[model samples]
Target: MIRILLADDQRLVRAGIRGILDDEDDLHVVAEAADGRAAVAACRELRPTWC
Candidate 1:
């Protein structure tokens, strides 16, 4: 599986992207952040394959 961290200031945008990516068999969303700082923090904690 490929882990992912999605970061965006817009909630709808994040939701939309998550929805699309979630349909894939090999993709997984492990974390979400509303800003760069939070994204960085999530990256450090989750260590997603794609961030």
Candidate 2:
């Protein structure tokens, strides 16, 4: 599976994105953040493929 981390201020946006990614067979959402700071922290913790 491909790990993904999403950073967005809007919870709905994040949920939508997660739904789309979750529907994919090869992609998965590993983490989410509501701010840049939180995103950075998640990046460090998750170390997603993109990061």
Candidate 3:
């Protein structure tokens, strides 16, 4: 499976992207962040396999 940490300033954009990515069996969104800083934090915390 492909783990993902999706980041976007817009909540709607993140939601939309999560929806699209979730549709695929092999693609999984493990976390979401609204900014670069948060993305980095999430990356550190989640340590997604794909990251």
Candidate 4:
């Protein structure tokens, strides 16, 4: 499985991306962030395969 961390200032953008990725059985969205700092924090905490 591929873990993912999605970070975007726009909620819609994140949602759209998550929606697309969600269709894949092997792709998983483990965390989300609204800004850069939150993104970093989520990255550290979740340790997703892809940022």
Candidate 5:
């Protein structure tokens, strides 16, 4: 599986993206952050394939 970290300031935008990715068979969203700093932190913790 491909792990992902979604970082976006807009709640709706993150939700929309998550909704689309959720339908995928090989993609997985491991974390979501509202800012770059938080994203970086989550990245270190989750070790996602992308952020």
Candidate 6:
């Protein structure tokens, strides 16, 4: 699986991205962040393959 970290201030934007990526069997959204800081934190915590 391709782990991913999604960051966006808008909830809809994040959701939309998640939805789109979720359709792919080889891709996964491991974490979602509302800001750059949270995104960094999530990346550190999840350690995604493509952060």
Which of the predicted structures, 2 or 4, would earn the higher TM-score when compared with the native?
A: 4
Instruction: Look at candidate 4 and give me any clashing residue pairs.
Output: none
lDDT of 6 by residue, 1-51 (tens): 899999999999999999999999999999999999999999999999888
**Which residue segments of model 1 deviate by more than 4 Å?**
none
C-alpha root-mean-square deviation, each candidate: 0.5, 0.8, 1.1, 0.5, 0.5, 0.6
lDDT of 3 by residue, 1-51 (tens): 888999889999999999999999998999999999999999999987655
Model 5 alpha-carbon miss at residue 18, Å: 0.2
Predicted structure with the largest lDDT when compared to the true one: 1
Model 4, range 3-41, lDDT digits (tens) per residue?
Answer: 999999999999999999999999999988999999999
Once fitted onto the true fold, the runs of candidate 5 whose alpha carbons sit more than 4 angstroms away are none
What's the lDDT for all of these models?
A: 0.97, 0.90, 0.91, 0.95, 0.96, 0.95
Instruction: Compute the lDDT of residue 4 as modeled in candidate 4.
Output: 96
lDDT of 5 at 34: 96
Per-residue C-alpha lDDT of model 5 across residues 13-33, encoded as one tens digit per residue: 999999999999999999999
Q: Which residue pairs in candidate 2 have backbone atoms (N, alpha carbon, C) closer than 3 angstroms, thus clashing? A: none
Better candidate by TM-score, 1 or 3: 1
Estimate TM-scores for all models. Answer: 0.97, 0.92, 0.90, 0.95, 0.97, 0.94
Candidate 3 vs candidate 5: the TM-score winner is 5
Model 6 clash pairs are none
Report the lDDT tens digits of candidate 1 across residue range 1-51: 999999999999999999999999999999999999999999999999987
Q: Residue 6's C-alpha lDDT in candidate 4?
A: 93
